[model samples]
Target: MLLLWILLILYAIFLAPGSGRDEIFHALIRGDFADVEPLVVTIFSFLGVFPLLFAAILLPDRRSGSWPFVLLSMGTGAFSLLPYFYLRGRFKGLEKIVTPVWLMRVASSRSFIGIIVALFILSLLPLTGGISLNAYKDAFMHSSLVSVMTVDFLILVPLSWYAMKRFRGIPSPISFIPIIGPALLLWQQRGEKDNERTE
Candidate 1:
């Protein structure tokens, strides 16, 4: 998770003012899609890391029942597992091997269920191509400085703070700032699970 945040934060920093890519996107939003093509190609960078990060964290697990939704969430929103996987791997011996039954169950978890619903709703948005595409194109072009920051905050904060805390285990400002929130959240969740088992 730290690694994930480092890369994302680095990318975000580069997007600050005077950055080439920032200027380029600015141009694209201003009805300069033709010029943005070469730059838009850079989106593949995010796409590449997306799948690897998702698979690394998602491929291993042992929670029982309804696991497919977990997988659906990973494939659609790969970063979700960053916290949980790192923490769990640390305490539980990586080679212990999560059972198939458990994996299915986690995939079907209530939390995961809600994510699936959101993903499906987002899929219906017209951003990919056609009229909706124009809407996104317009927003990026006309959006205010505050709007962009809001987007960045939404992406960076939840994953680093709340999601990390709820799903992974965030303990302090250091780890939280570093995007190790996932690892922190995982530690807490595992402890809770253990306590439940004991009870």
Candidate 2:
């Protein structure tokens, strides 16, 4: 994971190609989606969901001081997060800091997870009309923001699966479903815990 993170940084800095990144970035920041492709917007929105999913699964552990990286990932995506995973793998004795009860309650709540799942679905709705692969391909080749974000999304998918297994033990088969999968696993885990309490 460390090597992968290094490679990703190197690629983004020196190898990724494209122009007008500033314009697209500023447009996105300003909520001017009029000129952006639906696919690009969808992928950008998914970046938000990825971090929330990670927080839901990782933050409650207390041993994992990964909240900082997860918070930064809301803007930088995998660039900010890969290091946390790397350290998590290298260190087993991470200091057990106290996670706030309210934060844990919010992170593990069914209502919160349901809202996140709804956002995930909303993010996908933009692409329901079918996007042209060729256009996206061209943008990816020529737009650095699009290319880097696309790669970031891909990296987060397997990382999510890995985090699930490491933190939650054997992940549900449905957890393999990409963005929403890990979230579903979290929801399922929360349900089990609730059931245990009730019983």
Candidate 3:
């Protein structure tokens, strides 16, 4: 997630200001999409990744004083995740907050995974002649919605892999596949079928 933020910063420095792409960047930042091409702005603006992220952040709630971290996350991405690492020994109460089977189930659900994968794919749809590479670059570089979506997607990609490895213990290669990865991870989480086969 820090890498995502770093890349976003680099994009802002190189692609979001002064001549060339600067004007486009400004328009996108201001939500002035009248000049942006195709569904690039439209689709990215509506993806629900932020809400998903917020829900996860809020899971620990005031009991652990984790809500402020969610606000911090809104501004700093993975830096906001620091509270979790920082409070590791400070509190174990969060375990009760996070131990619900149903919540994990929801996170691992096919629909949730599909929405995430679809958001990533839709974010890339401009690659097919919808806009110039530079145009896409500037939009991502400056558009608030686009930057947020990209960061969340980047975070989710690695996070999903980590969850699968740590919890599901599936073969390494399975997590490398796109849509199938999240599906299989959640499926294993959902029942004993995979565990039975493995045993």
- Per-candidate TM-scores read 0.28, 0.91, 0.47
Model 1 C-alpha RMSD to native:
14.7
Of candidates 3 and 2, the better by lDDT = 2
Best by TM-score: 2
* lDDT per residue as tens, model 1, 40-88: 3223122223232222224434431113423553333334344344455
lDDT of 2 by residue, 1-199 (tens): 8899999999888888786545666767788876667788888899878888888888777657777777888888888888888877577654554556777677768888898899899999879767877877877888888788888989988888888888878466666676788877778778999999999
lDDT of each: 0.39, 0.80, 0.50
Q: What is the model-wide C-alpha lDDT for candidate 1?
A: 0.39
Error at 87, model 3, angstroms? 4.6
Cα lDDT tens digits, model 3, 1-199, are: 4464566566544544234444544666786766775455544442334334333323323343444444565455544554454554577775444434555445444466566556656655554555565765666665654555455546545554553464455546666554345454544454464467688
lDDT of 2: 0.80
Clashes of each: 23, 0, 0
Error of 3 at 34 (Å): 8.5
Q: Name model 3 segments beyond 4 Å from true.
A: 1-90, 98-131, 144-152, 171-180, 188-199
Model 2 earns a TM-score of 0.91
Q: Compute the lDDT of residue 19 as modeled in candidate 1.
A: 24
Looking at model 2, residue 195 earns an lDDT score of: 98
